[model samples]
Target: MEKKLSFRNSSFLLLFFLCAAGNVGAQVNPADVRYLGKMEGYWTMKTKLGIYAEKWKRVDEHSWKGRTMRIEGNDSTKMDDMRLFLEGDAIYFSIVAVKDSVGEPVRYKLRVLKAVGFVAENLQGFYPQKIIYRWKDETHMDAHFEGKQGKTTREIILQYTRR
Candidate 1:
Protein backbone atom coordinates (compact mmCIF):
# COMPACT_ATOMS: atom_id res chain seq x y z
CA MET A 1 0.00 0.00 0.00
CA GLU A 2 2.81 2.49 0.79
CA LYS A 3 4.64 1.65 -2.48
CA LYS A 4 1.48 2.33 -4.50
CA LEU A 5 1.03 5.75 -2.86
CA SER A 6 4.68 6.68 -3.50
CA PHE A 7 4.40 5.78 -7.21
CA ARG A 8 1.24 7.91 -7.60
CA ASN A 9 2.85 10.90 -5.95
CA SER A 10 5.88 10.69 -8.22
CA SER A 11 3.69 10.50 -11.35
CA PHE A 12 1.61 13.49 -10.24
CA LEU A 13 4.65 15.69 -9.62
CA LEU A 14 6.14 14.80 -12.99
CA LEU A 15 2.95 15.71 -14.79
CA PHE A 16 2.61 18.97 -12.93
CA PHE A 17 6.15 20.08 -13.74
CA LEU A 18 5.72 19.16 -17.39
CA CYS A 19 2.63 21.33 -17.63
CA ALA A 20 4.37 24.21 -15.94
CA ALA A 21 7.30 24.02 -18.34
CA GLY A 22 4.99 24.10 -21.32
CA ASN A 23 3.31 27.24 -20.00
CA VAL A 24 6.68 28.90 -19.61
CA GLY A 25 7.74 27.90 -23.13
CA ALA A 26 4.64 29.49 -24.54
CA GLN A 27 5.70 32.83 -23.12
CA VAL A 28 8.99 32.87 -25.04
CA ASN A 29 8.91 35.14 -28.09
CA PRO A 30 9.51 33.45 -31.41
CA ALA A 31 11.96 34.88 -33.96
CA ASP A 32 10.67 38.01 -35.71
CA VAL A 33 7.18 37.19 -34.48
CA ARG A 34 6.21 40.78 -33.85
CA TYR A 35 7.68 42.18 -37.08
CA LEU A 36 4.27 42.81 -38.60
CA GLY A 37 2.72 44.28 -35.49
CA LYS A 38 2.60 47.77 -36.93
CA MET A 39 0.31 46.64 -39.72
CA GLU A 40 -2.41 45.30 -37.43
CA GLY A 41 -5.50 47.45 -37.51
CA TYR A 42 -8.44 48.59 -39.61
CA TRP A 43 -7.46 50.62 -42.64
CA THR A 44 -9.41 52.27 -45.43
CA MET A 45 -8.89 53.92 -48.79
CA LYS A 46 -11.35 56.05 -50.64
CA THR A 47 -12.04 55.34 -54.26
CA LYS A 48 -14.18 56.98 -56.86
CA LEU A 49 -16.83 54.30 -56.48
CA GLY A 50 -16.76 54.02 -52.73
CA ILE A 51 -14.37 52.70 -50.13
CA TYR A 52 -11.87 49.85 -49.86
CA ALA A 53 -11.23 48.58 -46.39
CA GLU A 54 -8.71 46.19 -44.97
CA LYS A 55 -8.43 44.55 -41.59
CA TRP A 56 -5.29 42.93 -40.27
CA LYS A 57 -4.98 40.94 -37.08
CA ARG A 58 -2.22 39.03 -35.41
CA VAL A 59 -3.11 35.34 -35.46
CA ASP A 60 -0.12 34.22 -33.43
CA GLU A 61 3.35 35.28 -32.44
CA HIS A 62 4.58 34.54 -35.97
CA SER A 63 1.58 35.17 -38.19
CA TRP A 64 -0.72 37.96 -39.24
CA LYS A 65 -3.93 37.44 -41.19
CA GLY A 66 -5.68 40.07 -43.25
CA ARG A 67 -8.92 40.50 -45.15
CA THR A 68 -9.82 43.15 -47.68
CA MET A 69 -13.11 44.23 -49.19
CA ARG A 70 -14.59 46.87 -51.39
CA ILE A 71 -17.82 48.64 -50.52
CA GLU A 72 -19.69 50.20 -53.42
CA GLY A 73 -23.09 51.78 -53.07
CA ASN A 74 -24.61 49.27 -50.65
CA ASP A 75 -22.79 46.15 -51.80
CA SER A 76 -19.62 44.73 -50.33
CA THR A 77 -17.35 42.29 -52.10
CA LYS A 78 -14.49 40.41 -50.56
CA MET A 79 -11.23 41.14 -52.32
CA ASP A 80 -8.76 38.77 -50.84
CA ASP A 81 -7.49 36.90 -47.81
CA MET A 82 -3.89 37.59 -46.92
CA ARG A 83 -1.45 35.92 -44.60
CA LEU A 84 1.95 37.16 -43.50
CA PHE A 85 4.25 34.91 -41.54
CA LEU A 86 7.84 34.52 -40.60
CA GLU A 87 9.68 31.41 -41.77
CA GLY A 88 13.38 30.96 -41.21
CA ASP A 89 14.83 34.38 -42.01
CA ALA A 90 12.22 35.35 -44.60
CA ILE A 91 8.70 36.67 -44.28
CA TYR A 92 6.12 35.35 -46.72
CA PHE A 93 3.01 37.11 -47.88
CA SER A 94 0.20 35.11 -49.46
CA ILE A 95 -3.00 36.27 -51.03
CA VAL A 96 -6.02 34.31 -52.17
CA ALA A 97 -8.39 36.38 -54.19
CA VAL A 98 -12.13 35.74 -54.28
CA LYS A 99 -12.14 35.51 -58.07
CA ASP A 100 -9.38 32.92 -58.08
CA SER A 101 -10.98 30.83 -55.42
CA VAL A 102 -9.69 27.44 -56.50
CA GLY A 103 -6.08 28.10 -57.42
CA GLU A 104 -3.04 28.19 -55.21
CA PRO A 105 -2.47 31.46 -53.41
CA VAL A 106 -0.19 34.07 -54.92
CA ARG A 107 2.88 34.35 -52.77
CA TYR A 108 5.52 37.00 -52.24
CA LYS A 109 8.62 37.23 -50.14
CA LEU A 110 8.97 40.35 -48.05
CA ARG A 111 12.39 41.80 -47.30
CA VAL A 112 12.82 44.62 -44.88
CA LEU A 113 14.73 47.32 -46.71
CA LYS A 114 14.77 49.86 -43.90
CA ALA A 115 13.20 50.67 -40.59
CA VAL A 116 10.27 52.36 -42.27
CA GLY A 117 9.05 49.58 -44.61
CA PHE A 118 9.59 46.45 -46.64
CA VAL A 119 9.59 45.32 -50.26
CA ALA A 120 7.78 42.23 -51.44
CA GLU A 121 8.43 40.42 -54.68
CA ASN A 122 7.26 37.45 -56.70
CA LEU A 123 9.90 36.76 -59.31
CA GLN A 124 8.04 33.84 -60.84
CA GLY A 125 5.74 36.01 -62.91
CA PHE A 126 5.30 39.47 -64.37
CA TYR A 127 1.83 40.45 -63.19
CA PRO A 128 2.95 41.52 -59.74
CA GLN A 129 6.67 41.55 -59.91
CA LYS A 130 7.29 43.84 -56.96
CA ILE A 131 5.44 45.66 -54.25
CA ILE A 132 6.81 48.35 -51.99
CA TYR A 133 5.20 49.28 -48.69
CA ARG A 134 6.31 52.49 -47.05
CA TRP A 135 4.88 54.20 -44.01
CA LYS A 136 4.20 57.89 -44.34
CA ASP A 137 3.36 57.94 -40.65
CA GLU A 138 2.12 55.60 -37.97
CA THR A 139 -1.41 55.98 -39.30
CA HIS A 140 -0.76 56.17 -43.03
CA MET A 141 1.03 54.08 -45.65
CA ASP A 142 1.53 53.87 -49.39
CA ALA A 143 1.71 50.60 -51.25
CA HIS A 144 3.15 50.70 -54.74
CA PHE A 145 2.83 47.79 -57.14
CA GLU A 146 5.03 47.40 -60.16
CA GLY A 147 4.37 44.95 -62.94
CA LYS A 148 4.46 44.43 -66.66
CA GLN A 149 1.56 44.42 -69.09
CA GLY A 150 2.43 43.26 -72.60
CA LYS A 151 5.32 45.54 -73.53
CA THR A 152 4.66 48.29 -71.02
CA THR A 153 5.58 48.64 -67.37
CA ARG A 154 2.67 49.50 -65.14
CA GLU A 155 2.54 50.86 -61.63
CA ILE A 156 -0.27 51.49 -59.20
CA ILE A 157 -0.13 53.20 -55.86
CA LEU A 158 -2.59 52.68 -53.04
CA GLN A 159 -2.79 55.13 -50.18
CA TYR A 160 -4.06 53.71 -46.92
CA THR A 161 -5.20 55.48 -43.76
CA ARG A 162 -5.86 53.81 -40.45
CA ARG A 163 -9.50 53.85 -39.57
Candidate 2:
Protein backbone atom coordinates (compact mmCIF):
# COMPACT_ATOMS: atom_id res chain seq x y z
CA MET A 1 0.00 0.00 0.00
CA GLU A 2 2.90 2.37 0.73
CA LYS A 3 4.49 1.68 -2.69
CA LYS A 4 1.15 2.46 -4.39
CA LEU A 5 0.90 5.82 -2.59
CA SER A 6 4.47 6.76 -3.54
CA PHE A 7 3.82 6.02 -7.23
CA ARG A 8 0.64 8.06 -7.25
CA ASN A 9 2.37 11.08 -5.66
CA SER A 10 5.18 10.99 -8.25
CA SER A 11 2.70 10.79 -11.10
CA PHE A 12 0.74 13.74 -9.78
CA LEU A 13 3.84 15.91 -9.45
CA LEU A 14 4.95 15.06 -12.97
CA LEU A 15 1.57 15.95 -14.43
CA PHE A 16 1.53 19.28 -12.59
CA PHE A 17 4.98 20.24 -13.90
CA LEU A 18 4.04 19.28 -17.45
CA CYS A 19 0.95 21.45 -17.40
CA ALA A 20 2.89 24.42 -16.08
CA ALA A 21 5.53 24.09 -18.79
CA GLY A 22 2.88 23.85 -21.48
CA ASN A 23 1.29 27.08 -20.32
CA VAL A 24 4.62 28.89 -20.44
CA GLY A 25 5.35 27.71 -23.95
CA ALA A 26 1.90 28.58 -25.22
CA GLN A 27 2.05 32.21 -24.13
CA VAL A 28 1.94 34.54 -27.13
CA ASN A 29 2.17 38.32 -27.29
CA PRO A 30 -1.20 39.83 -28.05
CA ALA A 31 0.38 43.04 -29.38
CA ASP A 32 2.39 41.17 -31.97
CA VAL A 33 -0.66 39.35 -33.24
CA ARG A 34 -2.64 42.58 -33.37
CA TYR A 35 0.10 44.31 -35.34
CA LEU A 36 0.00 41.56 -37.97
CA GLY A 37 -3.78 41.59 -38.25
CA LYS A 38 -3.78 45.31 -38.91
CA MET A 39 -2.49 44.72 -42.41
CA GLU A 40 -5.25 42.41 -43.50
CA GLY A 41 -7.28 44.30 -46.07
CA TYR A 42 -7.14 45.91 -49.51
CA TRP A 43 -4.96 49.04 -49.90
CA THR A 44 -4.61 51.30 -52.86
CA MET A 45 -2.11 54.01 -53.83
CA LYS A 46 -2.45 56.27 -56.78
CA THR A 47 0.22 58.36 -58.43
CA LYS A 48 0.32 60.49 -61.51
CA LEU A 49 1.97 57.65 -63.38
CA GLY A 50 -0.10 54.68 -62.22
CA ILE A 51 -1.99 53.03 -59.44
CA TYR A 52 -0.78 50.29 -57.09
CA ALA A 53 -2.90 47.96 -55.06
CA GLU A 54 -2.00 45.56 -52.30
CA LYS A 55 -3.98 42.87 -50.58
CA TRP A 56 -3.02 41.30 -47.29
CA LYS A 57 -4.56 38.50 -45.26
CA ARG A 58 -3.69 36.69 -42.08
CA VAL A 59 -2.59 33.16 -42.90
CA ASP A 60 -2.43 31.97 -39.30
CA GLU A 61 -1.48 33.14 -35.88
CA HIS A 62 2.11 33.82 -36.88
CA SER A 63 1.94 34.83 -40.51
CA TRP A 64 0.39 37.25 -42.97
CA LYS A 65 0.35 36.79 -46.77
CA GLY A 66 0.15 39.52 -49.38
CA ARG A 67 0.16 40.29 -53.07
CA THR A 68 0.78 43.57 -54.91
CA MET A 69 -0.10 44.81 -58.38
CA ARG A 70 0.38 47.87 -60.52
CA ILE A 71 -2.27 49.21 -62.85
CA GLU A 72 -1.95 51.64 -65.71
CA GLY A 73 -5.23 52.28 -67.44
CA ASN A 74 -6.54 48.84 -68.42
CA ASP A 75 -3.26 46.96 -68.01
CA SER A 76 -2.43 45.30 -64.73
CA THR A 77 0.99 43.97 -63.79
CA LYS A 78 1.53 41.63 -60.91
CA MET A 79 4.43 42.89 -58.84
CA ASP A 80 5.27 40.37 -56.18
CA ASP A 81 4.09 37.96 -53.54
CA MET A 82 5.03 38.66 -49.97
CA ARG A 83 4.82 37.08 -46.55
CA LEU A 84 5.39 38.30 -43.05
CA PHE A 85 6.00 35.81 -40.29
CA LEU A 86 7.23 35.69 -36.76
CA GLU A 87 10.25 33.39 -36.68
CA GLY A 88 12.17 32.79 -33.51
CA ASP A 89 12.48 36.20 -31.85
CA ALA A 90 12.21 38.39 -34.92
CA ILE A 91 9.75 39.14 -37.71
CA TYR A 92 10.73 38.25 -41.28
CA PHE A 93 9.46 39.53 -44.59
CA SER A 94 9.88 37.40 -47.69
CA ILE A 95 9.25 38.44 -51.26
CA VAL A 96 9.19 36.64 -54.59
CA ALA A 97 8.89 38.84 -57.62
CA VAL A 98 6.96 37.77 -60.67
CA LYS A 99 9.94 38.33 -62.97
CA ASP A 100 12.55 36.71 -60.80
CA SER A 101 14.45 33.97 -62.61
CA VAL A 102 16.39 32.76 -59.60
CA GLY A 103 13.31 30.91 -58.37
CA GLU A 104 14.12 31.73 -54.80
CA PRO A 105 12.56 34.13 -52.35
CA VAL A 106 14.38 37.11 -50.89
CA ARG A 107 14.04 37.44 -47.16
CA TYR A 108 14.50 40.48 -44.95
CA LYS A 109 14.59 40.69 -41.21
CA LEU A 110 12.15 43.31 -40.02
CA ARG A 111 13.18 45.11 -36.89
CA VAL A 112 10.58 47.27 -35.28
CA LEU A 113 12.22 50.60 -34.57
CA LYS A 114 9.24 52.53 -33.30
CA ALA A 115 5.75 52.08 -32.01
CA VAL A 116 4.12 52.23 -35.43
CA GLY A 117 6.82 51.13 -37.89
CA PHE A 118 9.41 48.55 -38.85
CA VAL A 119 12.47 48.64 -41.05
CA ALA A 120 13.86 45.82 -43.14
CA GLU A 121 17.36 45.88 -44.50
CA ASN A 122 18.79 43.86 -47.36
CA LEU A 123 21.53 41.47 -46.27
CA GLN A 124 22.07 40.03 -49.74
CA GLY A 125 23.79 42.99 -51.42
CA PHE A 126 20.70 43.66 -53.52
CA TYR A 127 18.85 46.71 -54.64
CA PRO A 128 16.47 48.29 -52.14
CA GLN A 129 18.96 48.07 -49.34
CA LYS A 130 16.32 49.26 -46.94
CA ILE A 131 12.55 49.20 -46.72
CA ILE A 132 10.42 50.97 -44.17
CA TYR A 133 6.76 50.50 -43.41
CA ARG A 134 5.13 53.07 -41.16
CA TRP A 135 1.54 53.58 -40.23
CA LYS A 136 0.46 57.19 -40.51
CA ASP A 137 -2.84 56.35 -38.88
CA GLU A 138 -5.34 53.52 -38.63
CA THR A 139 -6.33 53.90 -42.27
CA HIS A 140 -3.06 55.02 -43.88
CA MET A 141 0.47 53.69 -44.28
CA ASP A 142 3.63 54.81 -45.99
CA ALA A 143 6.10 52.41 -47.54
CA HIS A 144 9.50 53.74 -48.42
CA PHE A 145 12.24 52.02 -50.39
CA GLU A 146 15.84 53.18 -50.68
CA GLY A 147 18.39 51.56 -52.97
CA LYS A 148 20.75 52.02 -55.83
CA GLN A 149 20.07 51.62 -59.52
CA GLY A 150 23.45 51.46 -61.24
CA LYS A 151 25.47 54.38 -59.84
CA THR A 152 22.50 56.48 -58.84
CA THR A 153 20.69 56.28 -55.53
CA ARG A 154 16.92 56.14 -55.72
CA GLU A 155 14.31 56.55 -53.06
CA ILE A 156 10.59 56.09 -53.52
CA ILE A 157 7.70 56.52 -51.14
CA LEU A 158 4.21 55.18 -51.70
CA GLN A 159 1.33 56.28 -49.54
CA TYR A 160 -1.45 53.76 -49.16
CA THR A 161 -5.03 54.11 -48.01
CA ARG A 162 -7.23 51.24 -46.94
CA ARG A 163 -9.81 50.47 -49.57
> Which pairs, if any, clash in model 2?
none
TM-score, prediction 2? 0.71
Alpha-carbon TM-score of each model against the true structure: 0.71, 0.71
Cα RMSDs, all models: 20.9, 19.4
Model 1, poorest ten-residue lDDT window? 1-10
Q: How high a TM-score does candidate 1 get?
A: 0.71
- Clash pairs, model 1 backbone: none
Steric clash count of candidate 2? 0
lDDT of 2 by residue, 71-107 (tens): 8999988888888888777677777751224766666
